[model samples]
Target: MSKLGENLLKISVILMVLLSLFLSWKIWTKPANHQFQDRTDKVKAVIQKKEMTEVYMPTKLFYHHGSGDHFLYTNKESTMKSLHEKIVSLGFGSSKVLSTAEITNLTTKRDLFNLVYPSPIPISLFINMNNVSATLPHDSKNFLFNWLVMSLDDNKLYFVDYKNKTGIEFDIKGNIASIASILDAESNNYVTAILPTDELNYAGIYYLADSTKLKTYSYIIATQSFTTFSRGFFNQPNDLFSNEGENLSLSNSEGESLTIDSKTGEVNYFGKLKQDHSESINELYYETFQYVEDMGSSLGNLRYFSDTGNEVIYRNYVEGFPVFGDNMKGSMAATVQNKNVFIKANQDTLQIPLPSDDSVTLVPTQEVVDSLINKGVDMSKVSDIQIGYKWQQNKETQQAIDLVPSWYVNYDNMWMTQEKLESILVKGGHS
Candidate 1:
């Protein structure tokens, strides 16, 4: 009786263990169902994710000799990307404030390489907005500057505001052998440029010295995800619905709305905002990052174009030139109203580059400015002037666009073409 009972108990125990193992294998092999939004986020993740430095990169790079002449490398895209990685890899040491006089004096004996940002970016903005852990120091913690210049002579880097004439300076960590090799190798494609010292009318803007040829590109464009925007810009995603009108109107019961223009494919979103301080630029920066997870658009090389106190703008760039147009062609904006934030973008973004045989050569910046002044473009209203690729439709196809290089005048921070300004002046109307 004892032997049979013991054997039966052993058999029962083995069966129970086998059953548990079978159940565990089933749990491991069968896929767990995910929620709808979670799956949507996974799809978005495949397309959208960008670093702040990746999006807010410097627009221009200049190699300056000891004699004070500046040169721009024509191999822009590859050169800049490699150089950016190298500089950040070396990181930075302690930085001290350098007055304009100090910078000028220091430049007298140094070979300078400058990386010019489109706008003065603050350190706090990167930290609060994108959680960037850059190698900036405590002394240079919050310096605001648009220019990041490298002094190869002293192995130093200066982050300076050209107009303000003040910036933080930090000594370099290593020798300039790597930087020198790249510059020397790419010297074949270097082009002459007019900096602040060369031309007064450049007005803190850099210009190509002569007429240059640039390729025109065509792109297959698309829009930001409606699902992502609803979750982000609205109070509740489920409660938000749309109306089919002239514009595709999106709204929730919580007084937030976003409208997409059907004809032009422009997007304008409005939402209630709560910030600790009204004048805090950092607050706006954080809000900008929260609503838009990534500044990236498909097939678009977007960078920071400009920012006023109340708004920030980013535009798609090709070979160092910003693309400008109202049909949203790749322009993005974040604006802060009194108690609300307005996020505006084109319903379409550049997706795929198409083949193009088009190219354009425009007159120099000085000649363009002179023509504008002759045409009665009021100088007082013009805050900044720049060359941009005017985004237009291709006559043959609806799938692509023509990017023509043209001079644009920024009227109090608003950009418009020279022809538009001339028309306004002719009509006795303000631009």
Candidate 2:
């Protein structure tokens, strides 16, 4: 009986050990092929061929920041050689090896001729001659011309005539006669005429107008030409007097004074002045005219003049009416009079007294106090509720401040005003 039992037990133990080893192997060496496949599908769903095409692919443009003239062309060798030749022809020195990323950065800093992809030749050569002119030596005949026959974007082949201060724009549309008439009219006396050029697909001419026999500039931007007007006495005339204009009685630190006329845009100047002045001069401050303007259909022109030193006194006008009126329009009328301050509104008044600090204190209303008492709030334990009200409504310090019991040094010594305490208590429905 004992032998049979021992044999059975030994067989069972061996079988259990074999089963445990198999399970451990399966868990440790299992392939992660399903996990990899799940990740691949997720990436495929998010990345599409069309979306990838929108990304900016590397082009054949190269840049060389070294001392020598070098550039990188297309990704292809044949295309690179052709672009190299074109760059040399454009007076870009010589060509050398450069990286595409470097070329992109250079293009952002300075305009470069964009080349056609797959094609070795540069399709469009862009020259920012406006910025280039600053670096080049100034010459009367210095001009930039584009002989390239191709066109891309808004770029067009044209020649700039810096000698005559004229630009000939090509590929222009519309009737040239109407443009010529408008240019001639606004050409002022400085421009001679706007003639049409004989170039194909191009129209417009550059004419030099007389400006009192003095040479003046006529700026040409695209299809427009701006003729500068010469300075004349009538150009800036004096301003008219008006009410609603700022009272210029205040002393100005700036010496310049303004005179304006509302009937027309006329401005006059009284130059600069100094600061120190006696009572006699101070009395004349009201009579002193700082600035005038006629506020017609517009908000009116404002003139700033100096009464003393270099400080400017701003004066505004209301429909070209002077603020003084026949009489002093109550210029210095005292609207508010208090023990500590006198407030007045005047066109040319100065030196008014400011409100005193701590003039008003916020206190809880009597009603609130009564309610607190009814609520069993110990007056000895509760701090006095002070209500601070600004005597001057315009004062910025009149903001409400919360007065908790902890803010008071002695709860029993709460010294809130009767009026404020009553107001707070009544508003709280306690009184």
TM-scores, all candidates, are: 0.78, 0.15
Kindly give the stretch of ten consecutive residues in candidate 1 with the minimal lDDT sum.
29-38
Candidate 2 runs further than 4 Å off: 1-134, 137-253, 269-431
* The best candidate in terms of lDDT: 1
Clashing pairs in 1: none
Full-model lDDT, candidate 2: 0.24
379-406 per-residue lDDT for model 1 (tens digits): 6566566677888876744544677877
Q: Note the Cα lDDT for every prediction shown.
A: 0.65, 0.24
Q: With candidate 1 superimposed using the best TM-score fit, by how many Å does residue 248's alpha carbon deviate from the native?
A: 1.6
Clashes of 1: 0
True lDDT of residue 240, candidate 2: 18
